[model samples]
Target: MAMHMAMEVDQADDPRLQAYTSIREKDLTSGHGARFIIEGKVTLETALRRGRFKLESLFLAASRLEPLADLLAEVPADVPVYVAPQDVMDTVVGFPMHRGVLACGIKGEIPFPANFLDADAKTGGPSTLLMLSGLSNHDNVGACFRNAAAFGADAVLMDGQCCDPLYRKAIRVSSGASLWLPYAHGGTGADMVHAAQAAGYEVWAMTPRAKAQTLGTLRVPEKLAILLGAEGPGLPDDLIAAATPVRIPMSSGFDSVNVATAGAITLAHVFGARESP
Candidate 1:
């Protein structure tokens, strides 16, 4: 192909690079202006391949330009791709980092939580959802999204209590699954459950309580919503009381499965177990 088209940025304060400045601090807020940061080569590539979010721009370390030529060439000519020496990138990021790729994405219009619950209806087939609540850790949120996508869940519904899945760290941890996964954050756990149920999903709130139905014993449903809570506090008592409770049977006295892991096992049962002879 023809030579890669890119601009060389020598100063950290260049006007075009404003969106990438002090990204960590910007992450502290709601990715202000409905924007999010995509870091590392994998996530950047995922965003490009999925076309789920509009990329505002790309800032890469000088070394990455050649290695990512093919990927960069695919970038729309309208989007600015800026390359800078490692030192300038470090200054702009305000941190010690090893990976050399960064991207800014516009989240565009946020979707209604209830509307997203029905996005899969047009397919005329089974649909699955992964719901989360009170999960403050970005890593857990990301892992859950990764698992949900891996298991072919149609979407994710995270209550207001959960952290932003688009956070840069979460995006990297999820390998950019969140970029393509249909998710609606910022609703109460109750709101999520009601919406899923209204969409004809069998809502199962996952918990460690022994009285709940064990995952191995339950018959998975065609349209299902698996609800998981934060690490320390599983599902709230009232929430668990509201839905059919499901549990992953564990060895004696060992009920502490990471929320994300529990999600994977239950999802596997839904997507993988039935096919087994």
Candidate 2:
């Protein structure tokens, strides 16, 4: 591991740190230009390990240097890690995130969802994909990524209406799984279903509707695409009609779980079914 000396910063508005300025606002309203923020030591380290992103720079509290030095060695020599005192770091970002670490990562060109599905098809073996629709809540989005990773899903596909999984809180809530999971936003729920179908994946639309088959009956095909919708509205009826509709068996009158929890349960069942002799 190579150690690079860190640059010290005394001012909050240092032009070099411009990308991190008022970042909470950017976290809420906009995507940083061709870049996404990765915060926390673990998530930053995971991004480095995943090797899927180009790390632009790092901004860290001075105290983090010794702790993160070994991991920093793996970062390319060209990337600067800016070190600042705690208060200066707070002033620069206009908020205090106790995590004390942040990295700017360049977003690579997002390939179509079918591109990933195609890659899975080339294997001629079992493949699993998690699909999301209209999930605007960052926490739910993050939890979904976490569940997808836990169940061994190959990649995650989301409709445009879903929140960006790279949003800082989402990354944090995912505990860095978002950094490791392969994911992309496709067009819409129907578009995702078509993309999956075109790629030879059996599309299973998750719903609470009684007409849908209980998930207990599924054996999980060699290539499976499971679709989940936003909490309140669930999957659109037309989209559900298009795909094989499946529902988790719940209490008689009660309808649903949190979307993420629903994903976890379904994915767990699929994982177990796939493992069974």
Candidate 3:
């Protein structure tokens, strides 16, 4: 591969490098439609290779650039790749410089839930989707996406209340699966269930309620949407009432599991069941 040169940043405040400055604060204040940061070598590589989001710029610790030459070569020439000394990068990002890799990319428009579901139908195969409601923890959101990808879920649908899966921490935790997987954020939990039903999916609400069907015994459908909610609240009563509630059976004492864990178990079961005769 031909060598590509990245612009060097001697000063942290260069106007062209503003997106990498004080990243945490910028991420919080910046609206969802704006550019978001990607951190770590793996995450950066996935974003560049996936080509889902448009790359805006890359900021790397000057010392790490040589080791990342091949990956940097994959970047488009027109996109700015900025290399800064370790101390300067620390100053710009307002954090201790460690992993030494970061990139910024514009947020692409998310497809509507109905459109995403319809597109899966057009594929003419079994479909699985994960729907999240009021899941505020970035870690859980990211882990859920990772699990979705692992268990063959076609897409993830998040209600407006769920944390952004693109949040830097979430993206990192997901090992960049958030970028690779298709997702949409909008509407109420009830709306998501209804949309899945309209798309011919058997919407299964995951909860620990006594009335819920045990996951081990329930028959999985060809097209299934598994609904999960925040850790403590689980699914709303109305949302639970709207769909068939399913639970992971446990020993007598344990009543619940983390939402992401529950999602993984449920997804694995459903995906496996769909494969059986």
Against the true structure, what is each candidate's TM-score? 0.94, 0.94, 0.95
Q: Compared with the true structure, what per-residue lDDT tens digits does model 3 show for residues 78-173?
A: 788888899999999999869999989888677667666666564457888899999999999999999999998988999988888888999998
Candidate rank order under lDDT: 3, 2, 1
Q: Write the per-residue lDDT of candidate 1 for residues 1-277, one digit (tens) a residue.
A: 1245688999999998887888888763364368888999889889998859888899999998888888887787778888999999999998854798999988876555676765545446677889998999999999999999998888888888999888998988888999998888877888878887888889899998989998878777878889999998888988898799988889997886888999999988888854555
RMSD of 2: 1.9
lDDT per residue as tens, model 2, 1-277: 3434788999998999988998988753244457889988789878888747788999999888888878888877789989899999999898885778999988766656766666546557788899999999999999999999999998899988998888888988888888878887857778888989998889999999888999988768999989999999999888898899999999978999999999999999989988888
Candidate 3 displacement at residue 222 in angstroms: 0.7
Candidate 2 residue pairs in clash (backbone atoms < 3 Å): none
In candidate 1, which residue ranges exceed 4 Å CA deviation? Answer: 1-4, 28-32, 118-123, 274-277
Per-prediction RMSD in angstroms? 1.8, 1.9, 1.7
lDDT score for candidate 3 against the true structure: 0.86
Stretches of model 3 off by over 4 angstroms after superposition:
1-4, 28-33, 118-120
